[model samples]
Target: MSGGRAEGPRNIAIVGPYLSGKTSLLESILFATGAVDRKGGVNQGNTVGDGSAEAREKQMSVEVNAATTVYLGDEFTFLDCPGSIEFIQEAANALVGVDAAVLVCEADPAKATALQPWLKLLDELDLPRFIFVNKVDRASGDVQTVTEALQAVSQKPLILRQLPIVKDEIITGYVDLVQGRTYVYRESGPSELIEAEGDVADALGEARFAMLEQLADFDDHLMEELLEDIEPEKAEIFRDLTDNMQAGNIVSVLIGAAERESGVRRLLKALRHEVPGHGTAAARAGVDPASKETVAQVLKTYHTQHGGKLSLVRLWSGSIAEGDVLNGDRVGSLGQLMGQQFNKLDRATAGQVATLGRMEGIVTGDVLTGGGEAPELRRAPRFAPVFALALNVENRNDEVKLSGALAKLMEEDPSLSVEQNESTRQMLLWGQGDQHLKVAVARLKSKYGVSVETEKPKVPYKEAIRKGVTQHARHKKQSGGHGQFGDVTVEIKPLPRGSGFQFGDSITGGVVPKQYIPAVEAGVREYLSHGPLGFEVVDLAVTLTDGKYHAVDSSEQAFKTAGRMAMAEGLPQCDPVLLEPILQVQVMVPNEHTASVNNLISGRRGQILGFDAREGWPGWDRVSAYLPQAEVGDLIVELRSLTQGVGTFTFEFDRLQEVTGRAAEQAMANAAA
Candidate 1:
């Protein structure tokens, strides 16, 4: 493979909603560029982007995959990103390094609505973008209708660059609007420019004029010529379109059936002429790292089969070679990524993407320059692990292997985390959703051969007293010569919420000696750790009102025993109640599904706080509410079910709410049983 720099080495990310053929489009682009002999279908699980076992089984892109291809003498690096909302962070990360985006949209208007969030993200980032109407042959709607629907969501004016020629439900070819050329796909892989004829010519002329009118917005001379009824020069029209595209004023829309290889050649040619190359990328990204300072952004990290770990980085400036020192350390090895495969290289130049092999302490989103200067280039996307599972080694003897496997899994996906809960004695793994955790477990077994069983994680509930009570406990056990004797009266009171546990010595001179007071408090704290309801006790006060101790045989042990007994007797009598942690949740959903989302929240025992219309997202509302932590396990599934998988929420720990009556009783009964 040659590493020769092309005219414009542009990095573009293909992003859209779930099942919108983002991966398929990349596969088609790779095949069309002759990088792959045969295209891999997503259903068959053989696509390049979905190379992981979990992705193969699910037939979805779980992370970002960067692949480079030479299209029309221009080296194009395409980042194929997952379309599922759970993996939107992957897309966000890919967008940070890329200069532009190719927002793939399906022909269905309903399906196109799912791309609005992605479009909004692109607009916020101020990145240039184009629209690719994929799966045109299979779509029921016409190209013009789909284009109009897409234009409504796009912040920039979307101009059609290619018009599809349909005949009896089959698209033969596309008319190139810029050059006024009609290309018809031959039987094999190539397309030949044919002479325009009849209705095709008329349709082509109308589409070409519409494109020229949009292109004229960026060129004053062209606009004046168009207004004066003079045809603008072809070079001027193309120049205006390219300039406006770079300025993020206009988005070019192209129609093609990626699977059938229709209009792909024209699309590639358009990308070559319009997309920004390496020089443009470096200029827009700012100063070159080698000349002034070193700057390279880590786009992604991958764990290979034999090559170990590779951190794929985009060099914004400065040349990185093997043994070149950076950040007070020598660069280990420079390599290039071919899907999951890594190829060792001598060095990678500025304005190029290269795999930095065996980077000891580097992580995703890290910017490593020269002279011990390392800054974080981009903010990591918000990926909270909401779902959790209690994991245990199946063999019980592979505990070390299980720990190692969990660590490796975390290294691969920062979103998945594992922790050991000391009190519960359960190893827990948390992720974005059930599927996310399940995939992590699968990777553990497949990659490390560590078999583990998982179960629903336990909720950390608490117990609190509702009233004050006075209780007495006595420990008077006589065993042979030494007799154990101790007595205490504890004034147990309910503290205000969040007051926690309080201990005070109400005893006067030598009643319960100062030395033994510590013992009594320790015993009370031990009992408080595990309440009568089998949960931690919180927000209460325990004061030692009065007590008696034997001077001869009564020790701190005896007094501690008596204190534990007093707490056991007093807690149940003070109207003990169970408290579950509540999470304040804010769900963002489409306006049409607001009622359904509200009802779903109510059904989950959520307390509605307020609702407001989202600023940029039209026909969307953000519903803020509070729900119990226990009710949040499957909330994402339910919200997706209610809103056609277009809804998302963020939640945080709120104040604890008491669970009383039947709910408290049932919880206690279950814990006891």
Candidate 2:
């Protein structure tokens, strides 16, 4: 707690596409820092990053993992986030607490398309990032071509800091362009320094000059020095690199093989020199670093099998202790998380990632101030759900416990949502994709003791009558004490679509008394609830024309009974039809996949309205269509496959349309089943 900032912890997030070796990179970094004696493999299910049982079973990360280590006497906390498109919410939330990020990916240029969304997000947030070209040992082409491909997707200019040294078509080492030195990758021990004055001297000069030109864009003095045929000093070049990186003007590109720990030391060395201090990151996140108050924000949350709830937070200012009050709740324990393990700390300082135990009401993305209350945290609009499932408890006894479990799940991932559809009488859990729901189900069983099942939600179909019919019915009964008799004639007619239900009285000379009219309408409404087609009736009108009632025996109950009988006899005489819900969908995808998206809509029996370029999204199109509710259950899966997990849509219930022919019969049969 001081006015001046120190070179403290560097909070960096490891993020990339699925199967791009992000977890491998985290393991390599941890091992290089002497945090672990041995590196674990993903196939062996022994890695500290993906420690969850579900993740180990699937061989992928489903949530965020945090690990802390010390390098060069500065604390470094690296967050290993999920790489799957389905679990992107974890990365989006994790980025909020990180001071910087390492964008890991394969060396294949074609896979560069997958990095577009992630780069776009980082640029939008103005977060400094570095590109780690993983799997360079098996890269397909030269480094220049791959770097050019990657530059197409990034908003900031990419400065390549190293080049692969190939011999016999095998990458054996890398040349550091800035330091002008060569380091060979050896599996036995540390990388050995090789002389750059051999056959590689010419190639090294060209590469280093190109890297310097990138830095010269921000430094006029360097440009003048270059034009005057004078080489700039090493200190001047380092200043330009550090200044541009801290200002988010350029991205530093490095190469490494995380699986073999190749080039890992060079990556760490570059980070120690360039990564900014806590004050710079706090300003980037819109927090005033000079404020003499306790300010922290929760980035990710989890529930352990025995440790209760853990709120993973990044301290922006001041310090927090075990009993410190935050967001109106006292921190039960002060702990530091290393993967799945926690070590209690007496107190945590600014710029450190700490786990606050048993935060009863705190959720992900919360910012606590000195008042022990959460203040408003502004953020971008959240992504909408692209798939949903209707949830059911395996044992009905768990029905009462499901809500609490779901609330905790939502607290962990705000992108997930739940809504009880009253019209369909279903509890639907909405998420990004099928895998998201699968992980949720696993969490429910493991953490909350609630077993659940999921399936496609039922469509809320309605029925309406066509034409008109008039019928007369009488309810006559004789009891031991009294007699009951009531007669009524009613007319049933169909109204315009969306007209709803209406009832009118047109009795002549008060054949049905005013007192009994209310009961007659009540019976008509009760029958309308379930029509001849076994669905809620809509868009119809009913009238009471003529009726005969005895003053002594005709009570409201008798008149109600007569109304019910009349409706039963009249509604059948008219033709009834089913009406299914229609949704107006707006699908967005890259323009290259527009034709495929159009085909998808037609295959699902959807009518294409039109298409145009999406506003604010370059090279993307927004296509509008009208699709049935039943056909939308699995549309997201096909759309993602067609667009490489980038296509998305927004839809709402537009109107009800008539269902005829085979579709109507199938719907009726499904309802019966």
Candidate 3:
């Protein structure tokens, strides 16, 4: 991959925890590669990656920002992924097309836990990755000790590629352990190589040997050489490091201060020499590069105010042209994505990531093939929403447009879900966390031109009878046209829980017309919809014992009116009770946090059913409980806080349980309001 398009572009993603300087590192890399004249800071908000208005205001990336740049005679496309857990899906989506990733993180040992989620994901994907300990200037503690702490969290072995050169408690530069050379930073330019001839030299030798030991564990030949006590050549050492990394067996650690542009050149050199090529990533994506069939996978979807839809895709096997028919639809004009700006392109070669405009139907994670063949792929897992809100548009007229916009939003990011709660009559938007929904709201306003609001969904509380009541109701009205008369004696009684509503009648001796019996039952059913308790009535029975009617004036309408009157007067007298929906929740958290989770459930008035080992997940316990629907609004927030942000659970509606005390009082008050 050269600057002149001689080789295919190499895709590299920069990912890490929030505020870990991933965007800053991207800016430093671009600056060091001469792709940009100056580096951009997050606070200044001029960085190429955080270009969106929401990102600028928040001073962090909220989505994946892919920028194409040429570095050291190689074509490189860098994917800057948001680090917040709220936007993890974006990072995971971008990883599908990238050859490798730069795991950016701080050097604070206390923050080592923050990297666990990303580490687990990378290990799951088996993608080759490098850890760039970013913001070293702000970091404190020995680099080796910090690396050890990180090692404990990472499944893959961590190899120290370079050691920080600290002078008087300050990071001055770095020493390349493999080459035994020291380099001093030169301010936005290339670092100057210096002689490693003292304590730095001694430390370099030891670190280099340690790195070799980690690498040798994966290479039999290297292990033999190490056991024989033979000094391995630098060429052999580099080859083993490169091979093991490309095989996803080891993670090489590098340190850098992206804000100062320090250690960026070394990071660039490592990327240029070590990152895997497109063919390897293609094979992993289940694509055959030799097949010569045009294939592409959408990494993202962008809806512009004027440009319609642009599907950012990566061509895996063959070239994509201005009007090539891919899968089903004809490809629109190809455009090269350089940061936030889009440049027109006649065609994009294999392995190049570009945007295809007017792709109205295409969505993220959709695989487009020339021959319409099913691409062997494990569909990218949808992001499980940790929080939800009852979403609504401001204007009633915008409801139709809002649904359409949400559909497109869902198409763009499958991590989000939209559901209509039939009982509550509210539309719910579920996603990762508050920030995720905030970005979605902003996009709805800016791109789709729709304004939306969100609130906690109303709990679907129900009402049921507690006591039985018998009453006589009469519908008698004498109009000048005809005399209307109908009378009924009915009984309302509570049934066993879960028995649902039942209607029965016993009209004998022609006391009431037989044809009017169904109309009486229909009236009873309609009145149940709006019970005296101001909620859906359930688990109750209405019985008709006897009734009288005037033959000439007693029509079905009159009989129906009489039955409704009977229930209306008798239900309130029967002692109606509020019933709250309880959910059968299975909360899965690390065993260490089981006590906290148990406390959380109990505090919410939940009954602990039992706890057991979570199926298929080691070291995690599943605590089953029954909790009221109202307490589940922000359960994910507390669970994450208790378990270092790794806890999750699944739940279903269990049954309706009678609620008492202040909870019932508040529910009744809210329903009245």
Q: What is the C-alpha RMSD of each candidate to the true structure, in Å?
A: 3.3, 2.8, 3.1
Per-residue CA lDDT of candidate 2, range 191-280, in tens? Answer: 889897666888899988888888888888988987797888877776777778878899989998889989788878777777777887
Quote the lDDT for 501 in model 2. 91
Instruction: Compute the lDDT of residue 402 as modeled in candidate 1.
Output: 87
TM-score: which is higher, 2 or 3? 2
For each candidate, what is the lDDT?
Answer: 0.79, 0.86, 0.84
- By the TM-score metric, which is better: model 1 or model 2? 2
Candidate 3 local accuracy as lDDT? 0.84
The runs of at least 3 residues in candidate 2 whose Cα sits more than 4 Å from the true structure, single-residue gaps closed, are 1-6, 197-199, 372-374, 471-488, 507-518, 548-564
TM-score of each: 0.93, 0.93, 0.92
Q: What lDDT is reached at residue 224 by model 2?
A: 91
Q: Cα miss at 7, model 1 (Å)? A: 3.1
The TM-score between candidate 2 and the true structure equals 0.93
Q: By TM-score, who's the top model here? A: 2
Better of 1 and 3 by lDDT: 3
Deviation in Å, model 3, residue 455 alpha carbon: 2.3
The digit string of per-residue lDDT tens for model 1 on 1-673 reads 1122236467788998887778878888899898889888888877778888778888888878878777766667788988877676677766777767888878787676677788888876677787888888787787888888777767679998888778787878778888888888764376788988999999988888777777777777887897898977777777777777777888889877777677666667777777766655555555443464667877777766677677777888767888876665567778765567556778676767778877767767777787755554545455666668899888988899888777767666777788787656788898777777777788888878888999877767889999989999998998898888778999999988777788987898788988888989988998998897899999998999998988887888899999999999989999888998899998999888888888998988899998999878877899999998878877887887677566788899888889887767776786787
Query: For model 3, how does the per-residue alpha-carbon lDDT over 176-243 read when each residue is reduced to its tens digit?
Result: 88887898877777778998878988998888878878888877787888899888888777777777
Badly placed stretches (over 4 Å) of model 3 are: 1-7, 470-472, 482-491, 504-518, 548-552, 588-594, 609-623, 642-646
